[model samples]
Target: MTFVVGPVSVRTPASSANLGPGFDALGLALSLHDDLTAEVLESKGDERLEITVTGEGAEDVPRSGDHLVVRAMNATFDLLGERPAGLRLTCVNAIPHGRGLGSSAAAIVGGIVLARALVDGGADRLDDRAAFQLAVDLEGHPDNVAAAMFGGLTIAWIDGAAAEMQRLETTVETTVFVPPEAVSTERARGLLPETVPHRDAALNAGRAALLIAALTVAPEHLISATEDRIHQSYRAGAMPESYKLLRQLRVEGIPTIISGAGPTVLSFARGIAERAPQGWAVHELAVDVEGALVR
Candidate 1:
């Protein structure tokens, strides 16, 4: 197989998973994005790979082959049974890392899509479904990857070991309050119990279903639909300020939830940047209709 000449670019949207009680099932693609461009290089000396990253997390991310995006690209090339002699990659990012914004998922999905686009006739070789499966497998979860790959609102699940998802359109708007500090997903997850009361589980189930209706059709139900009894409160200590903001917003009749694992709070209602805590960055974002676009 021949590598495509010149560079291919991928624009991938950021995602917020577990909109409240959906747990590991619901996700929404946001307007924030990461732009990645890559091209095959002429083989010279031992420089097989070159990488540069700017914007969010650039100073902290790895510059070597083990970088998340490069690793993901390598995985895709392995699947295609071909390798470019030399490669160069550049990432311009707007999504903040470790901020419950699905940054890692975006990197993985973007890399896979970018790689597929760089190979001649690659769309015919590895279709979107196959790419999504590979992304889910690499991320170890389907929620964020589903939304990042397909866009809009996504409900993702596992069938045996395979990842499956349904995408839906929504007109809901959101404002995210991102804290100054980062919250590790692992640390937040470590605070959860092995199980929960049956009643809470039942409550989460019904609300998760209602959340679909609220997001897609009835915006009036957002406050009730976003109620959660599963994870947020249990992990509140990890991000007290975020949880406090969530409670404050809910009391004001504003629909709100902790974005993903925590430290970033998202409100369904807009015009609320003033409500953000001091030292936090806020962005009023719309739902991204197109998940990842190749150009």
Candidate 2:
């Protein structure tokens, strides 16, 4: 019998986390997506795993088990305590790697979804929450994973074995300004002081709370919502141009914030408007209501 297995496709949206003040707590999903295709084949004993990636960072990303997607699958299989059948994976990555686009989180979630579908009777056993847990555990963060899994603006907190998520309203059209440079999450985190002053911590807490409220209750508060007493200022040296551009946006009557850790910045505006820098390519995007899924 010929087992005609599919190149199962999974789509996960690009996300911007932390916003500015909501450190490790808030995230917003963008319209750009990472598309993955995985297929199961009766492989020869010699070829246990094979993967091919195309688009965006195809030239830069690994095409073997060392890839983050493959790592996510391996981690999932380990959790299930079963040696899964090998897979031939193909990824069409649209989101840029190390550009604050949550590309790694998307890859991790995409791999988990693909792995579940490829295994015998595994797809039926996997739930959204379960898949999300796997991605979060593998990615070591829940903000981006939650947005990739649940969609919209997501607020998540990790609690030992379980993760709690709250989906927020994404009412404005989001425009991203991606600088040419790529900033690693570790490097961004390293820029933060070991311990923020008590007053600064308190300020961030208040701003974070107000940001969440503004997302739900008052859209006008978004201007203030983008304020940060936590990460953005400290990492200004990494992407000084972004900081300068943000100030320019404020002067130009645009609401902008650092998308995630650094580098990529995002702005939310209504109507048909364009306030991006001349060299930047502005993609008119919206909130991706649907997260990672097979089609």
Candidate 3:
């Protein structure tokens, strides 16, 4: 019989995706993280799931199994080919959901990490690639998952039958402005048109390549690298202020880019004073190099 054991916890970083013209291809892991705890216990027929939330936007987050953490736990159980004896989950969310900060991906990744630790005894037996795939399945895209899993800046894509990943080093600073309100990811996705003009498609492809090149070959070119014609423009209706604010920052000598499918706007600047906009909570941050960890 499985007896009660100490809680297993996992922490995962928040991510910002799209990076202007890259759309679903480029993403970066931020220094912020979401922490999760799961306690395993002997069952007295208490098969139901329980969850508690605190920190950040916890007051508005759900405290039931229907939440993303619980859902990921269920997926883990299914993958393991065994039912969880019982799981009591607690999520301390530091990342705001739907703000293009990859809060959901964090929760999903956190759950998978905890579940693996509980079942496999440690990380040795778990397949890192499979774990990332599960997260991508949950995330509906690989951009955020790639960054959260690998840290720093990640570029991911499917290459026929296999997946490819490349991690790039970024020398520039990133400053993000998170609004008080939340924007639904589903709503942001729904706004995208099914097709784009050939010229627009070509434009985004060229800019995406240039952006990647700038991140490495010419860091100074990044001021012009953060250009887009596809997703960001179409998302303006959902976040007009972000668009206007981005343009305004550019004029102020700080180049701002839309973070993922954002309501969160990010700017690249050389220094703190140079980065701060007229009005916004500016967080000067570096990329998370260590990825996710738990002690």
Candidate 4:
């Protein structure tokens, strides 16, 4: 795998994982995206990596090889047994950071797909399954990465030593309510209990299955399907506002769930118009059918 072209561009969509009962198993890609461009530097054998980021977390994100996108790209090159001379990377980000919108997953997928394009000299060589496994290997989880790689609604799980994903079709439109505050995925995960009652575990299993049915065939069961007993209430202290908003929305008969780790709420309300509470931003996003694209 070698590249005659100097630059390659890739775009990846934002994703929401752990939809209600699924908990590290389910995710969906949204219409929001981030664009990244990778170019091989002219200086030969320099081995330097330069990254320029604009929009979103530009002020705080790294501008070197330590950047998530650059790391992913490097991982791809390592896997392909090819070394480029140097790299210049530019990122145009639109997804909000720490909002449970899979910003990191998008960056990882974008970089990997960028490498796939560059390795083939601007031609695509990575297939869907290969991309899913590579992203999962880098991310250590399949939920967010699966949606970002395959698009639509994805159910991802570990099969022995390998990761597997299946995409499902959903007709419901999604609305995400993002609060101004950010919730760290690490902190939110730390709040979960090490063990739960057997009954609660059984209930979650049932709900997860029903959630899939609600998303695919029976739309009316969505409310009951979104019921969860595993992680949400346990992490209430970290996102009181999101928990309160979720309760209020459910009371009003809206099928809403905490997006990914929380601090962002996702509602499958289709065309319904509902008012957002004060101090929250609302975005109406469709399910992205296409995951990542190269140009």
Highest lDDT scorer: 1
Clashes of each: 0, 0, 0, 0
Of candidates 4 and 1, the better by lDDT: 1
2 or 3, greater by TM-score: 2
User: Residue by residue across 59-151, what tens digits does model 1's lDDT show?
Assistant: 999998889999999999999988777899999999999899999999999999999999999989999889999999999999999999999
List the lowest-lDDT window of 10 residues for candidate 1: 41-50
Per-candidate TM-scores read 0.98, 0.91, 0.90, 0.94
Model 3 scores a C-alpha lDDT of 0.78
Which of 3 and 4 is the better model by TM-score? Answer: 4
Q: Model 1 scores what on Cα lDDT?
A: 0.94
Rate residue 293 of model 2 by lDDT.
Answer: 73
Q: Which scores higher on lDDT, 3 or 4? A: 4
**Higher-scoring candidate on lDDT, 2 or 3:** 2
Candidates ranked, most accurate by TM-score first:
1, 4, 2, 3
Off by over 4 Å in 1: 44-47
Show pairs that collide, candidate 3. none
Clashing pairs in 2: none
lDDT tens digits, residue span 66-93, model 3: 7888888778767866656667888888
Give the 10-residue window scoring lowest on summed lDDT in candidate 4: 120-129
